[model samples]
Target: STRMRFGRGAASPAGVLRAIASGGGTDAFRLDGVDHRDDAGRLEVLATEDLAVEQIGYADVVVLSRADACSPEALRRAEERVAVQNGAAAIASAARGEMRGPSTLEALLGLRRADFVQTTPAKATHHHAYESVSLTLDGEVDGERFADFVETEVARFSGRLLRTKGILAVAGLEQRMIVQGVADLVEITFGEPWGDAKRTSRVAIVGFGLDVGSLERAFTTCAAS
Candidate 1:
């Protein structure tokens, strides 16, 4: 977790500071539509629009209140801008936790997690495919072979493929490993040991403009034995 400051207008920040100083758990740093006045009774305002991501990135805490983190469209724009400019900034969404859309799957696929998030149907510019399959075999796998399988299967349906993530078991390793692939980039890491819950490998593939049947077949045939 990163420490960062929040930027708000007028009494909103002061109110938030007051709440925090008083040991009250306030939801956000908003003035609730009230006119903001400073200690001298003059309007207190910050240059929010003029502040660049670089400035917001330096605060140990950031605040958002009310409609700040509301809709999916807003969330998307905020995420894109923050990602490109504020790699080290932390965010505080004051609009409550009502926004929902992105999931662990999307995060894994996108290669990063977003705080204020929402989801809508993907655009038509690209093909997308998604499928979940379970592997019954409990044998150890050759890492190279597994990697090759993932790459080739994804490529076979590349026209529509966007992302794929799964956990696999190798014949010798007691613990399973994780695999994440996005377009042409793929990564693998050691994960927790297979639990008793299912003891099977699960895979989900998402592709753009790709046929689901073809994507499924690609994985089914990937093992190099």
Candidate 2:
């Protein structure tokens, strides 16, 4: 049998660092609360947060909370900022601490084990100017078309697209499609069925200085015809 231990902390990296150095091997590092800070004092707070992220050296994932209170544009911008600072981390959005399902768990813990011995300390990058956007569709989308759209858009926005994810209703599929992208890497997987519940599409995009209206319109075009 394999043994695993997990640890968490608030506004501090010491505990997490100690956990990583204990030789148990870290499965992942998650930075929560990416959307809760205000712009007025965000610079100082973001600086502290970036330092903590760098100290940890690597984060496998980032979670954005209080997403419901923010506009899609705000969410997208936040994702972009996080991407710029932690380019390798996957970003997920949560509302009132609730994530989608097993997919979130898989994303948080499914990565290759951290090899601290060969890992180099990360250098801090300033991320004060990032922005994001979110979109919600009340209908099903053509799966093939959506896939093509995502691939093209991610490539086109490679430099600015920090993170993108969607829980979608595919026109011919019963199972929900969960789409996630970090920079140019895109992952699409089938999730649990919608069962008797209402089917809808929800997507959030995080990027740098994105044209929110234009992106929203483009996404809307991917709906089934």
Candidate 3:
């Protein structure tokens, strides 16, 4: 596992990118409560400014620090917003830098090219240039139908869609399915069983100039009939 951290008062985006280029490893960004401020004064770990938002897009994993101080609603909103900015990035919430287990650290440090394939190397650019959308579906879905939907989506969206990943409940399968797509290439494989976890589908799509509503509706229709 490889890891690098950027302090709260680190250099600018250009400097960070330069460091990353030289460092030659996976990058993870930790956002804290002090960095985020909303209408309710300062919501710890729930709000972020331009710099943090931009970093989220470039990171392989994003950890929301000081989450214990934030309200449940605030944390939910923050997760939702972060999901839309970098759908492929693994997200987790921590309190005082303490996470559940080593798995969280592994998830943050693990760099899989197949999981997050970038169309273009990250550089200092406008934050709003790209967008990410996350979708959640309950119940099982038809495997073939889901595959067809992903194929069509990648074809239609083409280059604009940087990456897409999901944990799906495929009909007639005891184990969960992990789907990952980079541009036009997509892969689906079986993961662990549902076990005690809730059976649901969660997906994240990252790209530029996406019609999120249309994509969401199209994905919904792919559910098992």
Candidate 4:
């Protein structure tokens, strides 16, 4: 599992990293408030609570990006603020466009398995920023059908959909599948074996102005018939 990173500015701190971490099927476990970012590069007016607000005090790690855009003083000030806000969070800074290359991305998300583990629970705030729907299915699902379902939803949601991710229990594969998406982009790969974890498939869709009832119904049909 790659180390999940949350963007700054309007996007709340990565309270959702714990969920991604636990999805790795490791022996570790912890639940966190999810704050999936809205569409990348999209700007919007935020409420007072959504602006420069530190809702949680115990974030595991915080990645400071766009270092090239800020001077030494500005960067230092941002770091200082993070320290004051999430004192326990490990601070990592990245130069502009540093995350563009595939190799660079691998390094960022390839953090140690333990880094993703959270010791305390954080609640997700700022509901106005985005909406999310979680779906879990028992037994195996048809991989092809699941892919089709994702494609259909992404298209239907269009500019409103932000991301989709979770573990899947495929019809015949004992190894769990990791599903991830950003906008219309989606990918699936083999992960650790089911091991002692339940043989259940779970996924989540984060978007803006979603038709929850229709999405939930469409996703359920991905099950093997």
Q: Rate the local accuracy (lDDT) of all candidates.
A: 0.38, 0.55, 0.59, 0.52
| Winner on TM-score (1 vs 2) | 2
Judging by lDDT against the true structure, name the best candidate: 3
TM-scores, in order shown? 0.38, 0.50, 0.57, 0.49
**Per-model RMSD to reference:** 16.9, 13.3, 10.0, 14.7
lDDT of 2 at 71: 79
Q: Write the per-residue lDDT of candidate 1 for residues 4-117, one digit (tens) a residue.
A: 988663221323333433344565443111111111111012222323221232222233334342465654455433322222222333344332232333332233222212
Q: lDDT tens string, model 3, 76-151?
A: 7666555556767755666765753335444444322223322222222353566777777788888887877777
Residue-level error in angstroms, candidate 1, position 17: 36
Assess candidate 2 and give its TM-score to the true structure.
0.50
Residue 203 lDDT in candidate 4: 69
* Structural RMSD, model 2: 13.3
lDDT of 4 by residue, 1-225 (tens): 799888754543333443454356665663332221111112112112443333322233345566666677766666554433332233456565453222353453432111121112112345344454666788778989987887776568876544555678898788988765544445566778887777777766655666767876887898987
Lowest lDDT block of 10, candidate 4:
38-47
Of the candidates numbered 1 and 2, which has the greater lDDT value?
A: 2
- After superposition, the stretches of candidate 4 with alpha carbons farther than 4 Å from their true spots are 1-129
- lDDT, candidate 4, at 221: 93
RMSD of 1: 16.9
